[model samples]
Target: MKFLVLCLIALIHQSASQSPQASCQFENSIDYTCVLTLTNPNGLNNITEIEVNHMPNRTNDDVVIVRTSIFSTSRNIPSIICDTFRNLRSIDMFRTGLTKIDEDSVSNCKLLELMTVRFNQIADIHPNAFAENAELRTVQLDANNLTSVPENLFENNKKLVEINLSQNGLAVLPKKLLSGLSELRGLFLTHNQISEIYEDTFADATNITSLGLGNNSLTYLPDKIFSSLYNLLDVYLQNNQLMKFNPYWFQNAKSLRALYLSNNGITYFPEDSFVNFYKLRELMLDRNPIQKLPGKIFASLGELTWLDLENCQLVYLDPSLFLSTYNLWMLKLANNDIYELPGGVFGSLKYLATLDMTNNQLQAISSTSFYFHPDLRTVRFGQNQINAVDEKFLDVVNVTQLNMEQNVCADGFWNDDSETKELFRTELRVCFENYIEPPQYCPIGNEYERICELEAQTASLTLENAGIRRDLEGLAARIEQLERLISSSP
Candidate 1:
């Protein structure tokens, strides 16, 4: 029989020359992606996949990449590209341990777009797995250990845009959990242990725009909970134990722009809290124990520019408070318990630059305190109890780094007085003339030389008492001219 047809052509050329394995390549045989890099026992333990049904440049819309080399060991995520690449588009299983993912595990890949089980340990995921994937857009179950998420898991991925369950342990988020992901745009539940977040929780992810609930344990947030995210932009509630923050849940976040409530135990804040954030520009209420605030609370953020009230133990500040932050530039009231700053507080900040009242209890600062519009720069009154510095304080703007460290100067004041040390040396460079204490020393060894020896003996006793009154007026004018010439001596 022709030697059994040459022994079946030598067994199909030894199964197409031992099926691609020199660190398999051909990354794209014209959209038919292929990249099987397995090497550690060559194709690790005699290959667990890549049947490629007699590969001779496989095609059926081929897309296969079974990478495994980093001293490979944790394998089992290969359903052989869902049973030999039936037009599969993507499947990247990196650092595998994919503990669970049933429902035919990506059966009929249906042109899968991208499914990355990143740095895995993936804990169960069978709600029809990907419910027969409808061209999934992107799903990277980041650093997984996922707790629960089977409510129609991704409800038939509506062209799902992005989903990275960041460092998961997710506690609760199962109400229509991202219902029909309406084109979700970046939703990463940062380091979750999520504590309450319902109001139909993002009701179908209304075009979420960057929401990473930072280190979650969130305390409360359910009123209109982001009012359907109206194209929301930037929301990362840092750390978290959120105490209160319901400004009617952003009254329809008018395109919110950068808002990260740092740390958190947030002590209330609803004086029209950012009135629809009118395109807010960087606002992070630092730390938070927020002591008080209601003077038209930021007067409607008119495009506020970077304002992080550091520490927030704010004492007083309502002189038309921040007068609509007129383009404020970098203002962080560092570690506050602020004592006083009321008169037109920062008088409409007209482009004010870097003013961090470092560690406060400020005693005085009013020469129309920071008035008029003039791009002033860097003024951090370090650790304050400021004992007087109003020699026309900041004389109408133009400062260049003045930190007034740990103040309390008053005798011969601020540098042995050269007219109050040239009034803070023409707007500052006084570079730390130390003193948080030591100043009441009055043993007068030299009080400016005893005040210049009492003003030079009172000006030499006023010229010796005017020469004894001009010698008694010249002896009464020669005794009245000898008594009028001896009474006319006739």
Candidate 2:
């Protein structure tokens, strides 16, 4: 009888020792609530049976926030874990190898307000997965393999302020997916396969401020898709296949500030494309195939401060292209076919600070290329065929940083410093000794001709004044000689 009892006790001890274990530690106190962090370092497939050690002064009920990390093979969040933390307010699980979110996985945590299950292999989430978490305010499920989500997925979470579904395989958003998320402030759907958005998709998201839809396969957008988002501010649509830009997309989003449309197939823009975006501050149109821009295209964007047009295949720029964007602070025109900068092309950008014209075919940096902008600080002209730099180039624009590398000028001429003026003079006498001004493609308008005439008249007047001074000096010498002769005779 004693030997049988001993065998039974040994069997029980061995079975308990082999069970997977998850350790819990007390984190810093947040809002006077004890926060507990549970970690499974043994690649445990089951964490529900693990015992949790509460803080010295707190019990399981006293914990409000629970974070789980480093779980290598947990397929789903066990309901028993959330059931134990009935008063939980937040749960964060990252890179846990979770493949799916089962319905009511966290339904026991009634007070849950924030949930983050990012960087996991989660491909599907049950439509009612978060149905019971009515108070949920933020949900971040980015970097997952989710291709689609149900339309009513977030219907119960009315107070949701932000949702980040970026870096996923989502191809399309259901028409009513965000139907009642009136309190939504930010929605990030970048790096997905989204191709189309219904016109009423954002009709109820009137209060949304920032929308990110970059790096997608969207080739077209409905004209009135964003007609209801009046408070929209920043929009990111870069790296998409958008063939054209529609002004009606932002017809009602007057509060827009930043607009990004780089790496698209857009070839041109109508003159009134940005007429409704009066308050827009930043505009990025780089990496397009646009060969030319219409004059007065930016006439209404007086408040625009940043403009990017890099790699647009622009062979020429209209002289009055930027006639109204006076507040522009940065302009990027790099990696194009521009052979010359039309005179007064940047005359209206009085606040222009940084100008990038690198990797172009510009043959010369003329004196009138850059108009006087007091804040001009950086100018890049590298990788061009520039053999002639006007002696007055630096005098017109006082750029503190100038990049002229890989040009025809001597190495010493690329130096940009207080002595740059003297270096430029020396380079002109040596490298550009036989330089001839390139023929202007744009006609020298009446204003330019009138200025040239004025300059010629001034030069002729200066020569006449010098000759008069020499004659006056000779007459004074003769008069003094005569006076000395008269005095000697007396």
Candidate 3:
């Protein structure tokens, strides 16, 4: 009798652990894969919420998820549903008129990994909305009306990696707002009204790799705000009202790859400002009022590739400005007041491929100015005072396009050698005539070895002319002395 009781106990335990197979219908839609779904039951009760008792046993239950479309019209997600969908992985909702999430709504969703409630009118959330949902990894609440979030809302969720709360009315981030998410890799808060961020807002989020604060009203960021994020990769601070860049802002973020600070009122960048970003690659500072960049500002960013300083109202650039940016590929300096490019300005950018200096006040460029860049392919010097071109400018053997149109030159400057002009594919139109004396329109050497030989000849002639002028001045002084002596003697 004792043995028979043991067998009966074993059978009951197996039955409790295994759930019955749930019936499902295939939706056959392109965007969604068919999964275990719950349809509204027909009856007077109407089943306002799903309870733990309504689900099958844990062992037999398949992964359950609430489709985004169905949740769009759903009113709420009760705390009881967490018990029913114990094996659930995701819960998506949108446009459901969800105004608030009460406490413990999804506290015990042990297997929950992803949740999205975007494009809704949700304005509030209980502190325990996801209190103990440890397995939750991604939460996307973009396009909501949320003004504030619980400071400890994600305190119990250590596995949370990404949180996107963009397009909201958040004006400020409270300190410790994202305190417990230690594994977070991405935090996007773009297109908001955020004017300030607390110093300790990201105190515990050390693993964040990408942070977006663009399209906001931020005028300044507190010092050491991102001092702990060592693995940070990308930062977007565009479309803000920042007046300056603090040198200590990215002191600890050395693994940064891309930085965007475009469309701001930044007038200057401190020297050695990017000394900590050793592995940075892409930097965009376009559309700022920066008149100049400090020398050695990009000294430590040796791994940089793309740099955009377009429309920054720059009047001049240091000759060694790009001395450390040897690996730079694409550089855009279009729409500035750069009157001239000194020799060897781009000597350090050996890998530079595309250079855009269009719409500037460049009057002349030396023949050996681009000598270091052997891999250069395209160059744009249009709409300037450039009246002459040398064969050395086309030294890059693989150069495909050279835009020199709309400048001071004769219309038939390159017409004498139509073959080489066709081979180079340059826009050598005569937009203006040279007004200077002697009209230095000569380009030394042929297309193969375009050296400025006339420059040397001009230098020799200038020295001879200077000697004659000195002799004439000396002779005039002696004649004046003789005239004075003659008058005094009389």
TM-score of each: 0.31, 0.83, 0.74
* Candidate 2: tens digits of C-alpha lDDT, residues 348-371: 576889999999998877755553
* Highest lDDT model number: 2
Instruction: Tell me which of candidates 1 and 3 scores higher on lDDT.
Output: 3
The candidate, 1 or 2, that scores higher on lDDT is: 2
Shift of residue 350 alpha carbon in model 1, Å = 21
Checking candidate 3 for backbone clashes, the offending pairs are: 391-450, 392-450
Which tens-of-lDDT digit does each residue in 1-490 have in candidate 1?
Answer: 9999999999999776654332334455455555544322212223345533425756645554334434333334445446656666677767655566677777578778788878877788878888788888888888888877786788888998888888889888787868878998988888889897778778778998888888889888878888888888898888888888888876787888898988789886878888878788899988888888887777878788898888889887666667777777888888889887754467557677778888789866653445343466577777787775644344445555567676664222222223233556543333223212221221233212232233223322222222232232222342343343344435
TM-score of 1: 0.31
Query: In order, what lDDT does every prediction score?
Result: 0.67, 0.77, 0.69
Candidate 2 clash pair list? none
